[model samples]
Target: MAEATAHSIDQDDFTHVVKGIRYPPVVTEANLEAMLNFDIRDDDIVIAAYPKSGTNWMLEIVTKILSAGGRTDASSDDMVGKLEFQYPDEPRPHHVMLQECASPRVILTHLTPDTAPPGIAHPQNNVKVIVVMRNPKDTAVSYFHFLEKIKFQTGQKRFPSWDEFFQLFMSGKYNFGCYFDHILGWWQRRDDPHFLFLKYENMKQDLPKAVKTVAAFLQVKLDDASIETIAHACTFSSMKASLDNSRYRGRAVNARKGIVGDWKTMFTDEQSRLLDSKCKTKLEGTGLQFNFE
Candidate 1:
């Protein structure tokens, strides 16, 4: 593998990729203004993360923690279906879903800080927000596989090659803007009373404690037994199996192999060094850390 050249990043409005799933469009100042003016429920629970950063995993854990016995009734299928980020034209509007759901509605977004719905993530807002952090190297690797497993337009089955994808990823032109910038925006608010930050690697190291931490932030009281039930149900294997057998089978191809450090094999020495430099510079003095092991 060779060190790749930097590529131009595209900032298109709401592009569609991988089976009609829509990535939110470029967040112009006007767009952010609109979101700020929008109405949001006070009891809203927002989950934010870059793509392939254990978003779905966190969703399952948070959902199970809230629902006794680690499960909710079938009536919640509409709410459950709306948990992942959808295209701008998704049949149901995110705001509408929030309005329709019962109090303490849970919604997810892959948007950056500035672009976040104003009522949801404002510095003064006390809305509960869970932001999952992960090593961008691993995230990039997982996201690449996701793009491939998701059929592309023009009838192509796979995406641009790994080297090509890596360059585009480094340029911050791929999905959720620059990965570093997105995290930094949220990191600034870690001290906010309503925000909770969890590391992906730390969760892998100790799932029980991780689940408990999430529960505490959400103020969901669970005894030792309930915590254990949720931890078991949210295990990567259990969640993946559940998705496979459910209505989300093909739609969830990108949710496979919830492991860390795939970048070790996937990244060329040059690419690894480049990512390390970028991560180090962006994360310096921010006190955020990731375990690539």
Candidate 2:
């Protein structure tokens, strides 16, 4: 989500999150083991999403909504792990890190429910987890550009072409396994009081309404004026023009074309058809749908 995306591309050359774990879960076995053992806190807010699904954007929006005066910097102070590689010599265990975060911490992760840290996934943890998703077509396009950028940086081999990558994506053989599985795992938890699901396309189309919805979920009260400020701050144009966009020279910077239906330009006729067929079959009976248009 808001974690380092390119680093994985370089480390395994796009085969895995670390050495052993594959996509969907997208964490090394050691990382998963450490996460399973991590203790949960009574009050924590967790944001879960696949990479390039507007994790950073949602983080900014939720933080500002929580900020009484519409402040934007509150998220930066969130103690959730940055989702980076934990060095062997690291002094603190993963559980210790969670325990040390300031009160009411906001955590972020791309891991699906089965593999999520025990603390966040615990049945009685009482943490609020917000899951954001985008159409797979756009997610694939954004993921492609992100991998392409990372390849250049690491001098790792490119994925050959968009056509091949599409096939890989269909099979969920990419860095994260089947996109459908990632979405489905969380979709099953829709009824859980700890989970909140939102679509990126919906947020992009009606931001003020989305912000209002977020405020309610977080139990934060904000006036109409504050809502206006947050909606403006989270706009694609506003986020693209901000100085922080340039902080990373990778895909985070290319987040410029963060519009819906970007697949129109990137996917071929056959590719589009394949994705349509696969999605229909895989997502069938799940009641989960994506707005490709």
Candidate 3:
């Protein structure tokens, strides 16, 4: 089964398109339709971001907040809040399983707004969403490493080298599509009462502040001590230490170098300028800005 899954992972340039958006091969049209039509509880929380934009970190922080510092092991990777995925061995899509779980479900996805459930980002459903963003340069670098690490651990053939990977990323043909389009889709909806946009750098710089903000947004009030505890527990080092490698495939990929501007070490001058040009042009009028460092 592992070999078969690995073989499929090598299919079609390692990604499959759903409704014009690229996703991992694990996402199926049937499962995506199920997810799109899935019911969202009023109290549900959704975390949306492009791949490797500190998604796991935000999930940990929000999960801890929801539990009042208590962890929800049920919220682990196999869980359906990943919405678009349909694991190979599983009999059903993740969303079908999620349907059986109790509310207020916490969903995490790398999907852009259009492909995600309509009510997910809309205030009409009363579901609160936290949108996390990281500078695209760092996101591209991290995503490249994530794919590399997955290929190494799984013995998957046909992985791209750094140069090839960067070109794929720039072309926006990689999983989850263009970083600019994904984030900008959510950024435009930032003013809605149901949405809270966060920067990865800001969270890393002052996690306690991030924790407080998330707690408040979720209406999960926490004392100063509780907030401090959550901040400590959700730190990159702390979360990495607590990872269960057996349970989470490619788990280390989620926690790698959770720092700002690591892209500086990897991006060449030409590559850096190219990304900058893309960002500047795409984000020209939007008030949104990123701290590369």
Candidate 4:
């Protein structure tokens, strides 16, 4: 299988069309070969999360922890580049740019269960994986805003309204198929010594504890002061402010709103109920429940 073709849309219709180049429903044969057969380092870690579910937040935290004793040159763009997408097989020139550095690589991927690269599931060395889960309602709201910004920048207007976007999300027509499936697939593997499941809500509720949890899992140690600094830096407010004049320099496109439960302000009661119902119906018996209320 090859990468999924980019869906083209007129400026007027961009609101309804999904942006970004889609990959094949399954991993391409060549990409799968490269990933499964590649020699992975024991210290490497993978940060997996659904879109708009604090993936970048976790990446920033992990990067800070990993780069603590290093220089002050760590920037958001560097983090993004080092944290590669495990699937899709596209040769990321940016990754090549970052690979020249001596830092340990941390990969970020959104590949669903069936589509994830085999190496992530079965590492040659003792690699660790961290999967983050967020409430689907908030994810939907954040994703809709993200798509709107993408449409504006790409000069495409295919984005659907909040209502329509909610429907598409609930229907599993968006990327990564159903949200519940993505969460459960990784959740089931939480017991694997290498797998750690981190909930966005838990992180938000207690960031320091979350940081310690992650550090312990990755065998990365930090003193109390270092952990406090990292926890403070990873807060939504701190991240949002950092994007104001940070090195990433794409605030308008990437880091618009970083608060949790923004969906409550964006979605109506009816829409909320509908989404709640869909999540409950589809997510039953998965041993995972999202706080959509």
Candidate 5:
């Protein structure tokens, strides 16, 4: 297990982590205006989730659905091209790319409530938003491993242990902004006709059902056979293997450990308790709970 440091750090240092990859402490009025003014069609769909919360998995599922039983003859690379990130400068740009694509766009984003594009929050907008969530313990563990690999590949020597990483995560000092604020914002709006909430563990436990649920939300029709094919194709093992040897090649780090509950091996009892306490406090009355144990 990783140990937390007793060494004290200032708020500025902590806030720096939250701003990582996002750059610019604030999104700025100009940026928000640009995003809100952008054209959004009625047929568009957005996949919104926190970092390391199965956003890619949901992207794969939506791509497969749009492909009509995964027989569109497009490679995973082609599918990746279709499912783009909305936040370009941020850690994940899939959501931005999706916005630029043609009709029936499936964009992914990690923006918190405050940072969510103005187009998404507009009542007149017809696009559907699907939000996915994972247990914070698991999300923290996965995020730490992801950052470690990033540090290694980028030649950065400073890597925090799992416990240290958890503290930062709890403090709302990770990329894509605060986790509590992000999920809670979406959770509160989950009852909207255009919003759907999906859990990572539930998707991993039964992907076909999850895929079908998403398809239904998008009003996309998929036959039983097509559903099975997508379910099989989106499995963590299949995606990991496919991504491992794709044209993108050597860029598939952290894609292999896409299983649910992997955090069990990475978090200690104390760390789990700390995370659970934070979750309980932040998530209260939201009707959103996690199976950390």
Candidate 6:
């Protein structure tokens, strides 16, 4: 195996590759090792999404639905849940911290299926998984803007220009690896009863219906009134306001615009065609399709 590269956000920010997959510097070799052995409980609900794909929005909706509008302490961070970073005041890694949490934990991760907890990979584990995916074009555009935001905050160019980012993203050289690989890894397991596949576009189209689907998947019953309330609270504006006042103290949630086809404004015609052709080839015969608009 290649040596893991160490990077600091205060210094130069760079990604490292482990087992041929790229990840942020926070996701160290030790963390990846622990993640493989991480134990998942029966009632745990794991929300898996590629970065820039409505992860926090789904997290809010699911937690609210699970708590029946009551307060929930379920923590949702892409890296923390995957043991990529240790939380403050928490002595152990996140995977270890999860073991001490109460039952029916709402776990969030951006890890691919193979790298996620082994328990969720099996069909009979009783762990419910909610995988959220977005069209690659929009995802790429959003992710590029997100990186730029990070660069601005860190006062350093953490990533390349849009033209260079497009090439790196297409080659799967960016953090968390390729978008297509992550989507397909979980997409192949969509038939498992405990697994539920969601599209960000679909959720934006009718959030109340999406809430109902998630509730049903978790076996949590909710009336139309409750669904509407959760949907309203999960809207982009509402959630952004809540996050703005949140004590979590992480970087921005990067939900800018939150609309589909934003890629049209950013991507050149050839770039669009390139992504379209790549998606067409990767997703062919999988019966999975995405709506650009």
Best by TM-score: 3
lDDT of each: 0.69, 0.70, 0.78, 0.65, 0.66, 0.77
Instruction: Report the candidate with higher lDDT, 1 versus 3.
Output: 3
Give one digit per residue, the lDDT tens place, for model 3 in 1-293. 11222223344645667666677767777767765677888877888989889778888888788778443445444345477776667787767777787666788777777888877846465689999999999999998888877766545687777777788788776778888889999998987989999999999999999999999888877899999998999887888865545265645456777899999989999999998998899999999899998
What's the true lDDT of residue 290 in model 3? 91
Instruction: Write one digit per residue (lDDT tens) for candidate 4, span 1-293.
Output: 22221242122222222223233222233443344344445666788887778777888888887777453356655664322332224455333333454446677777554556576765545688889999888888888888776555455535567766676677665655567767777787866788888888788888999988888777777898998998998887778766555543233355766656788888898887887787778777777776544
Candidate 2 per-residue lDDT, tens place, 40-97, comes to: 5676778888777877778778777766534334553353443422334456543456
Candidate 3: pairs in clash: none
lDDT string for model 5 (157-263, tens) is 55666666677677765556568877887888876888889999888778889989988877778888888898999998788876666543223664957776788
Mark the regions of model 4 whose C-alpha exceeds 4 Å error after superposition. 1-39, 69-76, 80-103, 244-252
lDDT pick, better of 4 and 5: 5
TM-score of each: 0.83, 0.83, 0.90, 0.79, 0.80, 0.88
- lDDT-best of 1 and 4: 1
- Candidate 4 — what's its lDDT? 0.65
Q: Write the per-residue lDDT of candidate 6 for residues 1-293, one digit (tens) a residue.
A: 33332322222245567788887655666878887777777777888888889777888888888778443555343223443555444567767777777777777778888887787666356688899999999999999888776665445754577888898789887789889999999999987888999999999899899999999988887889999998898888877866565544342545578898899989999999999899989999999999998
Better of 3 and 6 by TM-score: 3
Model 3 scores a TM of 0.90
Candidate 5, 68: how far from true, in Å?
Answer: 1.0
RMSD value for candidate 1:
5.4
Better of 3 and 4 by lDDT: 3
Question: Which 10 residues in a row give candidate 3 its minimum summed lDDT?
Answer: 1-10
* Residue 113 lDDT, candidate 5, scale 0-100: 50
- Which has the greatest lDDT? 3
lDDT value for model 5: 0.66
CA-only RMSD, every prediction = 5.4, 5.1, 4.2, 5.2, 5.3, 3.8
Ten-residue region with minimum lDDT total, candidate 4: 9-18
Error of 6 at 120 (Å): 2.0
